[model samples]
Target: MGNLSVGKADSIPTRPKRPLKPILSDAKNVPRRRIGKSHKGRIALLHAIAHIELNAIDLAWDLIARFSNPSLPNDFYSDWLEVAVDEARHFTLVSKRLSELNTAYGDFAAHDGLWEAAIDTKDNLVSRLAIIPLVMEARGLDVTPGMISKFRAVKDYRSADILDIIYSEEIKHVKVGYSWFMFACASMGLEPKNTWQECLKKFYKGNLKPPFNIKARNLADLPQSWYI
Candidate 1:
């Protein structure tokens, strides 16, 4: 019976061999600050965000498939699956906006940094949750408002509207990650703040850029004391 659970190991879900593309490249080479107050620059910005959302879809599913844990309650699966759905919707909405601009996802080069975070933390569910949703998704919370403002400044209400929706929903996604990470820490009798800090030091190889959205992060239960 290969179908049987072997002493509590959950069946591992298969990983996608490759991400849906715009030809992955180094983050350094990715065109930076393309969100200038111009039509072409706006298109570049949307393409970049669409790329992140597409990778987000895969990353959510990858977490479910790569880190299946039978002992963990069903809520964990439910959380990530729900996140996957949200990310899918986000990708669809942004891609539609790209279509409106007579453009699509592959029109520009994108950094592999997001998926790289997923790959690096694939081995540990805790690190994966910490790095992906908490660290990565949390970064979205930090930067999105500026994007929304940028779009509004250029009178691109349609794109701004879409980003508004994503900004709201992403708060919940980050909350889910924070909740799960805290749950894991409690299970192992570790302090949440200390353990999270340690994980960031060990697993996240990059520094968190400042000018953070402290208020939004506070809403998600990630206090400044932990990061600062």
Candidate 2:
């Protein structure tokens, strides 16, 4: 329960994800920019999806690693462990389907935007949950239906189906974030809603930009009363 007892992950007080080398991943062997849309497009998209899942792996594990403290209840590690497992499942599902699509992870260029948020929040768990699951991953929940439609429109049934499952599960994941965020605030005797907006402003340097899904934010238990 020591402040310094987070396990297994390379500790970082700043830029926790600066070195997401994916040492356990062989995605580098996968080809980049394969051709022909017959299955190539599906392959590329799934490749990107796999990359996301990979980043999610580190993100969840680091939660356990960076925040294993007496401030957290005994159950906190188990919750983050569950997240790690779920993200593993997601990566496997997308990777398997990507093979079916005739490509694999690293078969296309991808960004590390998701992990950037992870690094940004390494200073505190409340701010971590606020940005990771609430702001960023919550957006994943909001746009999933459209992703399904786009996949459907292109007739990639397997891709569409996989995305559907990820969509449904992501909601529960964000709910996990909301639950812990409130718990942290309540346990620390801080105002949950006020801290939420304050953290958002502090992290993003002001109001969150447009294209925000207020509905999904509400679903994540970010009540409108919290807006600054």
Candidate 3:
């Protein structure tokens, strides 16, 4: 007497991943000068922002479609849904900025590097959290402030504005990762700090660089002990 919805087995949804070569080709062909020099080097800046946004879109979708474990609570799906929405919004912000620069997304050569990590972390929930949000996306917190200051120096308000939204939302995204990661850690009786240390030593792409946004890490609900 097994439960199968009283009839049919559960089904997983299918969503093909985004194409890469096509996106990169469009990016390469677009002329860089169409963006006004009046914008003070903002054209290049806007293009870079657009590229990150595009990659974020793919990251969000991949998480939802691949991690469809019915045993996880509905809150799990809801959490990811929020992330997908924010990623899409961030994409729009940068895309609009590019338009104001007289350019568009896909106007420069970019790679699918963001999705590569998603695929690598796909097989396990802990690996997914430890890699995607904590290691990769959280790097944005450490790096974006400097980028924002540069844009501000160039008087590119739009670019900085878009970055502000991303920085704020990224805190929440990282928090989501931390929540689930702790849940998984507890479920498996793995000490959180030791597990993260082992994961970093094993799967981390590079050194866990410093200049971290300590405040944001706390807000993201990372173990307080790590911050101290």
Overall lDDT per candidate, in order of appearance? 0.83, 0.72, 0.70
RMSD to the hidden true structure, all candidates: 3.5, 5.6, 5.2
Candidate 1 structure, TM-score to reference: 0.90
Q: Give the better candidate number (1 or 2) by lDDT.
A: 1
Give the Cα-based TM-score of candidate 3 against the true structure.
Answer: 0.81
Put the candidates in lDDT order, highest first: 1, 2, 3
lDDT of 2: 0.72
Name the candidate, 1 or 3, with the larger lDDT value.
1
- Model 2 C-alpha lDDT per residue in residues 1-228, reported as the tens digit of each score: 235344444554543443333333334644353323466555665776787788888888778878777557756777777878888899999989877766666545676667767878887889998888877777677667776887788677777888888877777788888899999888878888778877787775445545555676666666666542
Model 1 RMSD in Å is 3.5
Best by TM-score: 1
Instruction: Compute each candidate's TM-score over C-alphas.
Output: 0.90, 0.78, 0.81
> TM-score of the candidate numbered 2?
0.78
- Candidate 2 — which pairs collide? none
For model 3, the stretches where C-alpha displacement exceeds 4 angstroms are 1-16, 19-41, 224-228
Q: What tens-digit string does per-residue lDDT give for candidate 3 at 84-191?
A: 889889988888877877777765666455556666666777887787787787777778887777767767777877888899999999898888889888888888
